[model samples]
Target: MTEVGKTPWHLWVVGGLSLLWNAFPAVDFTLTNLQNDFWLSQYNEEQRAFFLGTAAWANACWALGGFGSFIGSLLLLLRSRHAVPAFLASAIGLAGVSYYQLVQNGETLKRLFGQAPLYTTPVIWAVLLALIFYARAMQARGVLR
Candidate 1:
């Protein structure tokens, strides 16, 4: 007997959308880490300084998180089981960076960025969690090779 519904249409839709969504962060992380002056110019003085002053480790975590999510999206598209670990890495990196931002730089970020994080962070975490669980579920269902 052959397995039915090995690949679902929603899988492709989710994977494609995930990849597209993650691309923004990935590209932003790359550009900011490289200190791309043109892009940096878009931000105000305080924002620019805050970003430039970010510690190396925090930047590393940002890179890992962004790239990990990007890779996880790709793996999902390819129907590969490796998406699990990739998502895990993304979560770890996000947690590390978020801790630094909230714990160490909260006042500074609030003074500079205002309420943006308050609105965005929760949604970001929600999507990350959903993607993680979704990927795991697909793996458990034997759709991911």
Candidate 2:
């Protein structure tokens, strides 16, 4: 519906990348739910907790980002700025935690991702990111608050 050649850059880059993230599991699920001693009788108390905590952080980030995208994108698409961009920026900062989760190649997710692993909800992420940016743009344009 947007006029041809009128598509926004972030619309494609961020939004499209989000979709790419959703195409796969995004990050390893086991990493978040599992502890180093998940299956072992004698698990490293510190390490186990560390890994588990690490995973939790990752999920938290993803959710944070998702929430931002949800509210921001919705407002943006609606051409409003009822919510301040500062809140959205903070949310995005928290979402950065999700990026921490990921098992790369043969490396365990408990450590750090060897490389950014494929995300589980690329399409969803893309749609969400689009909303955040859209709302931000609307605010910049003086369309809303």
Task: Return the top candidate by lDDT.
Answer: 1
Candidate 1 off by > 4 Å:
1-5
Residue 15, candidate 1: Cα error in Å is 0.4
Report the Cα lDDT for residue 116, model 2. Answer: 37
lDDT, candidate 2, at 6? 42
All candidates: CA RMSD (Å): 1.8, 8.9
Q: TM-score of predicted model 1?
A: 0.94
| Candidate 1 structure lDDT | 0.88
**lDDT of the candidates, in the order given:** 0.88, 0.46
Error of 2 at 4 (Å): 22
Worst 10 residues of 2 by lDDT: 22-31
* Clashes in predicted model 1: 0
User: Which lDDT tens digits does candidate 1 get at residues 34-128?
Assistant: 88998788999889888888898998889888899999999999999999899899998899788888888988888888889767877878888
Summarize candidate 2's per-residue lDDT along 1-145 as a digit string, tens digits: 2443344555555444444443232233333354323353344565455445554555666555544444544443444465447336535644465345432212454343333344533544455455556556645655544
